[model samples]
Target chain A: MSAAPEATWVPRRYRVDAVRPELNDTVSLELAPAAGEAPAFEPGQFNMLYAFGIGEAAISLSGDPADRARLVHTVRAVGPVSRALAGLAVGASVGVRGPFGAGWPMSAARGRDLVLIAGGLGLAPLRPALLRVLADRAHYGRVAVLAGMRTPREVLFRAPLATWQGRTDLEVEVTVDRGDADWSGHVGVVTHLIPQLELDPRKATAFVCGPEVMMRHTAERLLTVGLEPTQLFVSMERNMKCAIGLCGHCQFGSAFVCKDGPVLRFDRIARALAVREL
Target chain B: MPERDAAEARLIEAPALQALIDALTARGYAVRGPRRRGDAIVFDEVARLEDMPRDCTTTQSPGRYRLADAPGAGYFGFSPGADSFKRWLHPPQQTEFRFRREGAAFVPIESAPAGVPRQAFLGIRACEIAAIGVLDRVFLEGPYPDPGYQHHRDGSFLVAVNCASPGRSCFCTSTGTGPRVERGFDLALTELHDSRHRFVVEVGSDRGAELVAQLPGRPAPAAAIAAARAVSARCAAAMPERFDRERVARRLRETPEHPRWAAIAERCLGCANCTTVCPTCFCTTMVDRTDLAGTTATRERHWDSCFTLGFSHLHGGSVRASTAARYRQWITHKLSAWLDQFGMLGCVGCGRCVTWCPAGIDLAAEAAAIGDEPGAPSGSDAHAP
Candidate 1:
């Protein structure tokens, strides 16, 4: 909350420069600040996107962190707020309040092999981290990107997935719960790909982002294979009214998912994540 | 009364009390104090000492609250009611900002031109004062501190009142937050029910000392100071049994799957009365309103409770769908998780939650039941100090 009204609850104006449809219900919006250059954001950090007459939804930055001209957010229209945001025209106005919450341990994962997993639209948040890692390919060791979707149609970043799969430095695995006739990928949960990944558990760090249950199962598998809880991180989501943590909507135990995390060490939240409906 | 020297205390009679209110009113502060409204003691504007509730105290228990007559008790006889100073500071519904759509962009409409008026809260109980401190950490000390809260907090003055009459449901004694005013007030008053109907005023700030100097008050005698301490001691002694704060917090964190929650949920109505009456429960939801043409919009933040299914709603559905889970979230967050969030328990032991619960749910009793369960790990290494 700065002295300026725009910094508080009043959001800064952002114009939609581009809109790329991912799925029937999901789209990626590239927003350039209505005024100065866009603010820099870290991978896994999110913004509270406000629609004109509707409300705000917490959407993660899905663009490359190094990109400074525009902010990109991938929104899946599951509620009124997200629907209003996702259906906006390219030239329409939107409200943005972020670069909030703790980001993925990019610096912590440096010099260590990485295991990045996503489930459903969960790929949207992980996109920035994946892009960051790919940009610095030589700075890290073996990189594994495993994705799980309900169906082949829900697969996001199809073009980038293809580009990453063509690279020899990265391991990209896509799995769908139910595959179509044209689908050539594995059909199972994302946790199934964990056992097949070829990396030393001690030297590797993992970042898992998905629905609650999926993150839990992925964490369990990662731990069983000897990836210490500190070596694995998960991004959590809840109803976030005040993304700055004043509104208690996003509190999961002591951690206000908006501030203390969106990305949290597995060990810190392992006990809380197991508690049903917390 | 909680932390003050006898030499610094002042004994003020009814005339001096009225003079203090008048002086604050002259200073452009909206002096708010407890007054009897309907069947409850609620806060309202106080123009004089008589405007406050007199010879009144409250009888409170689980699911019940009633105004009772205390023969010799003075204006500050009652324990805190459902409404707290939070209703004045962080109002239930406050307009965050208004916006008007002009072509493709939305422009923010300026709110009221004038700033919020300074406020002087009179008769704030010790627990309620502690609750304000908790809210300060919440809205003032966060990474992105709320400007509205900061403005209200900075412009406000606190006048704490030491508790001489402890309600049946009150547990400030157990929480170690009350029975006497401590460090957070400008002026603290302890009503002496002994011989004369007077107040023992303890000046806490320069403003308090200035006001006391102006008012007609004599230096408090040793007997008067002793009486104030005796009042607090008697109040604490009369309250319910005390439970170890660390033990209760640890039990709640360790036993997320405890059967006690389900049992409590069966009786819990999910009405959210407890949170509504709670002073430190600061969760809120944004209500966005727009005209029929959808050209203008206003976003208002309203008090929201964890009991509501919508409070935890996500894309698919609500995260905490069951009554059991919502209750668990509220209790765990208040008692255990708050320590991890703000380094103090969210509850001030004001007991509004217990007295106002429609289901007659006593959280202290429930916490004790869980803490007393066999094999529940016991340690002082919990989140609380």
Candidate 2:
């Protein structure tokens, strides 16, 4: 076989200049283009971050959409690249490729009540969509944020949660799977919180992001509450290597999660989601 | 339009065949033909026509295959190898992207190589040619074409061989892909023997006819054509019992909770041997490797199987954590749901999975087992039937 073309070698890179620890294991890094303009990305789209020799990983963008100067990624240290990312200090260099995969359809939620459900590190991607809606509150109706963490230590954006709780325009509820002595809030799965909210199912749109099991259970709960399957959206996570469609690692059914979606309507993936293994 | 040619093509003797192969190489095409490798017959780069295996045969049973010595000179031997045309088209590993670091600033790097070499693959089985067609629908004609795959595929040539001997596990007839060449080849050959070994080569393209005319060979007799047909018919009759692919695809879409998945999953190691050997498995993963100077980072793309636990990892955990889930994902995707997306069957009935599997798991048997049983509702039936 002969050598492939040189056009295949170009790497898309963004720079991480600042790091902020949000929760116990979660750290948010602010990224800016090393040169030229920062790549404009959607709310739920993620980038593949390479920590030099350590490796590469798919990380969701966590900052607000209006912020063009920097890109923020909230990550938990679980694997090699994530661990290497957590170890980096401010001004440390990291390689980035793509603002890949489909993001949350904010326009689809216009003039509708928004229900945001997230668990553990899944809350990272939803944070941007939540903030984007809040920035222009008149475009949407009542906003409900339901977040669940494994423990009190894992709860992210504590400062923002307090602010959201203080606001009469937004309804924020927090839950933990296993709480410590200082915990003084709801203790149950994220799906359980769906019963507490009172909204017109027809007029509301929901966004869910978490483990596949958690997302499935959450979507089932929303359906029971009279929400149409089309009204419910979920963010899917897969082993995305390229963040582009070329590397077929992140395929969910026929769709490439890195290309078609990380965020998709529940009804769109209903048949595939019903498959036991996938 | 020109009337479809129905007359059988002429045959040429074995010694005269050397001149044809030489003519092909003289035109600067890298020719790959069958050769004995250990106990198997594999397709590899051949310098001359003499490199083709003369007297070798293969024994194939459900989940088993072995090469044995034959009585006479036979260019075609055994069954398909573990590697398929995928090794040449998609490749096992390739660089997708590269990056350069200039002091504190990391800049995007551009340095992809070049196009694939012009080559001709000789002695390709009819099933493999069909497999290539299946992949072409996926990587080329799909909504988004694969640039890397297109570059290699467009540069290569095909020379298909009719199956003179079918393996015990072979079921290309059931998959509607083989026993004889119908399409997807520049030239096709059928070997015959009456008094001496001769080959009946049919030109499928203008390029093939032009090349054949350049070779020093005589036209075949009517008796030679009859002998070639007899050999191909004998091979076709040897096809193994296969599952109803159309019915299986329908059932898999409806019966998501089939008990057969659990049974096969018990034997599956999630080793990815089946997908790796399969000609049409197109899943891949990416990697980034930096030079010692830390000045450049190369992003590499490598074949990845859905059988791995990490394939479905999310924020909190993986969706399909069990070996059972991974196995189910692979089988259901290949046989059933693939048709809905690609408008073509994913498998070519090559039987690579059956023979190459360490556990001796047969896909046809598994499909038949689950498909025959009445599927239960809900995901509670998590064990094998």
Candidate 3:
């Protein structure tokens, strides 16, 4: 029998329940599934958020993974589709395609000290993994989140960072590359904060997401700090057109970022990472 | 030729190929076959046997393709051309879905599935059939199968023609894909025009068996079957063996920073013609379009090439900043890394890349240069200390 493939690109309608401004250009859309329950997705996974006539962007699920009714995406207005998504009105309806790609390696980090590093909006995708770890605080050994923003204003989910910082057990380190007068924290690149991290190097598993340059730098520094390449994972951002890995935009050598990974082990992409234009 | 195959292989006159087209039409299929178009032979609709490029064959060299009229040539004389089942299957530009802005969000207008029309692809070469197999794995076997590709590929009928005149650039014999088709066809045809214009048909499946019964032809003589086999064997011998298929992936992945890459990239215009004509190069990008009032919109998945700078662009910039890098990525992916992604080699040895390349940049020459270059690092088990 000829098995005709069903359409995988069609997006299901979802209502933007609320559009809370996270930063000047970033908006956190609390989405509710129009029909049944929102698609159950793992932390570090992403959904293709479509801005109706605008386009689609691969936005990571930032809210609690346990919340089945709502899909939270912290979108930073970068490109055309992202700008449209960021400017989306509250109660506006949009299209959602996924819950695609491998989320952060949360299970692997169990019982190991977790080092979460974010550069710019790279923090958005990692937010879910951090929330997942915070919910089950007893499972993980030690949790440290290193975030770097362009300015203090660009720091996402500041309220939670403040709350988490008050806790002595969990280390929340936030830095700005070039902070203004209002900033009273460490001022440097994200990798600079890596040296200050006091976690046991052998047991520490770092999750880095940001610009390719930043990811490369963070991964290199983590390696120097006794984290093997395998122990370090990074969420890559590419021109992902088809979330299913068919469109070929997100191809990084053999790995299709949409399917095999948006999150991949640092060792796996090392050769390709060094290979320019791959 | 051995024991006169049980399926009743027939010796149908070359003209009788039209009857097959008629039958496919009667069964409600838009029959498409190779026909001459200016300096090239292309696949399009065919109603009569005369519509086929019987007397014309293509002469393809590196960076050149021209059709020439040759008297006393076989019915289907040319190697596979720039077209394949991809035109109808994984099309260049296809409107995936049409949506209208309804109040809050856009609602999809349930139109017929794109390119799922009942159609029959006639005169598909063995290599082309192999290409369809590659595309099938990519779009069908994956977890999220491409609906448009699957819709066209699954329902469509394939009638492949065995290669009797492979191009000068052809190397299907080495790739082990063609010279003759092994699978993925309803019917396989070998044009035997040695004595007189005729075709020896082998029924590939139940559908082919039924069609052969209705076409009014006697059982193929043992001599004609031998002639058909000889035709493909001749074509196979004509093709030059270039790349080492088994060791290609390993060699390419090892020599990423090879100096030969810069040499080839020197003449490479990065025009992307090779990728456009490549049947197996299935990289594509989506284009989102909106109406004047922004009430309606359509998303189109158009063919894209890896050589293009935009193909690898990420958040801030593209990974491939240099032409040398782009060329390296294309050849390495095509020859080597594809084996890791898809079990089969991505290069079908079609030679379309060689013929269509503006710089006459032969993949074989480039690959050989890397293999033979002095001081080139032999192995880079990257990440393996």
lDDT: which candidate is best? 1
Any runs in candidate 2 off by more than 4 Å, and if so which? A1-10, A135-137, A150-153, A163-169, A176-188, A245-248, A251-255, A268-277, B1-10, B95-116, B141-148, B217-234, B269-271, B286-299, B307-321, B379-385
Q: What would the per-residue lDDT of candidate 1 be over residues B8-40, giving only the tens digit for each residue?
A: 789988657889898888878899889888889
For B21-132, candidate 3 gives per-residue lDDT tens digits of 9988888788888888887878788888788876777899898888888887766777667766677888899777778988776678887654445889998888788888
DockQ each candidate and list the results.
0.55, 0.33, 0.49
User: Model 2, range B1-385, lDDT digits (tens) per residue?
Assistant: 1222435355777776677678778877777777778887777877777787777788776557778888784777556667566687788887766667676656666544574577788888888898888778777774446667877787577888898877766778778888888777777788776577778877677677778777666565667667777877888887755778878777777776776766777788888998998888888876668888778777677888888887777555676788877777777778876776678888888888888888888887787776778876754233332
Q: Against the correct fold, how does model 1 do in TM-score?
A: 0.96
- Chain A TM-scores for all candidates read 0.98, 0.94, 0.96
TM-score of chain B of 2: 0.93
Best by TM-score: 1
**lDDT on C-alpha atoms for all candidate structures:** 0.87, 0.78, 0.82
- Report backbone clashes per prediction: 0, 7, 2
* Residue pairs with clashing backbones, model 3: A277-B319, A277-B320
TM-score of 2: 0.88
TM-score of each: 0.96, 0.88, 0.94
Give a tens-digit lDDT track for model 3, residues A221-249.
88887888899999887788889868877
**What's the true lDDT of residue B72 in model 1?**
67
